[model samples]
Target: MLPLAAGPPFGPEHTMILEQAATALTLARLTSSPAWDRRAHSSVLLDLLHWRYRSRTEARLRAEALGLPTTGHRLVPVVVDHPGAPSADGVALTDHLASELLSSGVKALVGDLAEGRSGLLLALARASAWQPVVERIARELRAAFGPDVVVAVGPGVTELGQVTRSFREAEEVADAIGPASRDRPFHVASDIGLPELLYSLRDDVRLQKYVEQQLGRLVQHDARHGSDLLDTLRAYLDAAGNKSIAAKHVGLSRQAFYQRLHTIERLLGTDLESGAQRTQLHVAVTALESLGPPAELG
Candidate 1:
């Protein structure tokens, strides 16, 4: 046997090294204080990670660690710094945050809140490039919160801190659209026309009447059947055409679900099976959902 060491089997040398390493890490964490605990207890770090990575692990872990008791239901939280547009300091903060996110591995940025408005925070995702993710995030948020809140998702920015304006614009335009604020979940500068039209429509009792007359039936159908059908379709499309699973979501027999699809197709006069038709129906459904319940078609 080797001669007796100064400490236990590992010896003083190994123990000293391990202790030193722990001490160094602890010091680093302390320096990084308020310790967002990217690995342990998430906070703003979750936003950073979403910018960097496309998941909510830090937030989930932090929430769980705190005994928050969530449904394990994670939202792809799109964070828009409030006052949507960045101030000089805000810009710097966003840059640092963006750098932190890039270092973490985030792929897309979503927001269209106007500058000097609330910042937009989106869930980390890599589906359908930018638009689909924005739409999905918005739709899901609405389904959960029910039109009370409006979320704006900007386009994807390969570079850091570029989406600051997108988030700002999204919110400004959202407020511009007012009553029709939710029309598009993710709004890019290019989508300004829609918001302009939305502003006009807000005051147009006749147009609102037409929308109700034309789409109200479908809206009622969705509410009676499930307010989540739009999300269901989003998921269904995401899964690449699987009706059985979609049927299961709404708790319908495959046959009954098929019937529902037929009803949607008849009312919308569009085919859910085809990509183009699906796209149109998707836009229509989204618009209807955003508009909320219709009043009489007066």
Candidate 2:
């Protein structure tokens, strides 16, 4: 309730004016509350993640308003996906994660990403500090959400405009890990070995061409005849050219595996015993697995 003016000169009009002013004040207070601030932070973070600003000046201004670093800081994009979580509210999950990070002395801006998924922009004083920070985030998220939560940490960038690249890398890491991420819930893009190199070139036409050049005939044969020739080749290569071991792994007798290997060599026009050809095919196979299905190449 508003205090009435002294001297009894107030009328109904004055009361109405006071009431309107009080309503405005209440709205202003509401907008400045912590929940509202979280929403604002999320909005700015989504803009950053999507590179929605028209110019760096505009982006910097918005980030500055939210106390987010735009210069003299490195930002690492981290994506978290919890498929087993009970709730599908991404915004609420992000808000909870952001609050937890804040309490742990970590500065992060959170945004919703698909259902049950969240994106975070972690502010770092140095890019080298990302590993520890990401580990801490993974630990916290696992403790809060569950062990099934997947966390993918991308490379750190110094500019706000470059955050989109980091976010995309993180997203790719998450996708590449897929449902097989339970054994290792936390993955950093830079440290994921060969897949990281392949993922970096996922958009290159040459990468797809190389896979086609090396294994296209085998893949086509498998699709046409509904054969396991491609799987046979992979098993053979994975076993380091040991035909017997590869045969056992694929549940085939040595003679049956040899027949498939012979067919593979004939179709691919390469000797399975050539070290150079084996290395080349191995790389192509790795590219196919890392970058997803060969059908996606077309």
Candidate 3:
């Protein structure tokens, strides 16, 4: 017969370990004075993450504040600005975003409000290789909320202290995209182009007047007759004068498309064949779309 063990299987030993863990937790509570549960703990961590992303002062202190797993830098800040989403507050949006990112195999530290953008800070294996991830994240967020979301990525940095620049760059990108802000959807500091530049000047008085002068008749026509002259003109210009292509897009036959195009030329009293005229019409359509509903215009 084998000798009997000193106690039941893992009885006192397990009990002792549990008691030690409990005591340690109690001591920790005394030290921090708060036993952070799930929601509270998450909120606190997010707050710290926001602080670190916004702070450029001391690297060592920021790292210490962020705790483990984020101690190493090489961080890239991504901002998903969903200003047009009908969500109530920043907290709900941030929570949903954090969950989506985690399920997509990206470990993100989310901050509710950072420079008017929902902050998603993460460290990637390759610092300079984060664009595709940003695009995918934007798509996922748009699916979660709605399509009017813009994602801006900051330049990569080797130190946590340098991440604030990334955050600021992202903010600038979100602001610069303006009308195309909804169209571009994803922005990187280095990728801005003519569309973003033109859209950024949407509030220019002359530009607003130009848009109205060019497209206002089409707008009133659409509203009055329930016709689609504005959409037809936009599609026609978008097709670069390819009547068949524009017709296909607008679901009109070639004859019908030409008739509509002729009508548009007559309505605007400008030749659409000239490249300069085409350019002006296209820009005007874009500006009007950016101005939103006619009610807002009124």
Candidate 4:
């Protein structure tokens, strides 16, 4: 089995960790006997991941209280979230996630965040291959919760004092990634991309107007004529302005594809091959997708 992280702790416990985690989730869900239990059945994770403790002794005490095995390793903070305040079902889901991680011998603690989010503190004994571990857990999370659940994995910290910073990193990743499907359910702080940036800008009205302006012409063309120039433009841009590749993707010869590209350029009044125009279209397309299908394309 791969080590939880890349460094020292590797082997023996790797394969069964995910299975154990799944079992833990199942057991936790079964024990969800109460509804709307806001008492934070597990809040030590909040203290561990939010604020710094005055001393190592204090941190250790809190970790122990949360059933985290923090003696020989520094814990990695992982945060998962869904939209809106968590209902009883959501809480049960979070509890199951925490339990599964702990059961997998992950030396972890689980707690509910103020909103509809959950925090986890995991002890990975100096292992450097933690990315795979996070990815594995993420797959399980997506499978269990569908596409809406997002997992943000923080960098590993060797000291208790640094854990809150790691948690903060996880928080940023979770926010940037937003609600996701299983194909891309989790991300790290370092992986923030244009899509994530667009997601964060979803509330800005100006952003919406900007998207409408950039691609509105083609959208309207498609609506009016049953044409697919908008989709063709999307493919062209996505292909990085490579004519041959985009042509092949759109199932057209180079000549036909060039004609379509020319038509799109005339319609949009922008050079498809120009980097500036491509960037604008890219952002607009990303924004449109993020905002959901427009009520009126134009």
Q: Of the candidates shown, which would achieve the greatest lDDT relative to the real structure?
A: 2
Over 4 Å off in model 4, which ranges? Answer: 1-42, 47-60, 69-71, 82-91, 127-129, 178-186, 253-256, 294-298
Query: On residues 204-232, what C-alpha lDDT tens digit does candidate 2 reach at each position?
Result: 88998899899999888888898989889
Cα-based lDDT for every prediction = 0.46, 0.76, 0.66, 0.72
Which of 1 and 4 is the better model by TM-score?
Answer: 4
Instruction: List TM-scores for all candidates, in order.
Output: 0.31, 0.62, 0.62, 0.71
lDDT of 4: 0.72
- 1 versus 2: better lDDT goes to: 2
Better of 1 and 2 by TM-score: 2
**Model 2 weakest 10-residue run by lDDT:** 176-185
Tens-digit lDDT string for candidate 4 (18-55) = 54456446445644553322233345566666574455
Against the hidden true structure, what lDDT does model 1 obtain?
A: 0.46
Query: Residue-wise lDDT of candidate 3 within 103-135, one digit each (tens)?
Result: 777755665454345776776665346767777
TM-score of 4: 0.71
lDDT of 1 by residue, 154-219 (tens): 455432233334434444554544444446555445655543555534545655665565456666
What stretches of model 3 exceed 4 Å from their correct place? 1-59, 68-72, 82-91, 96-109, 114-116, 125-150, 175-207, 251-256, 294-298
Candidate 3: the clashing residue pairs are none
lDDT of 2 at 245: 94
Of the pair 2 and 4, which is ahead by lDDT? 2
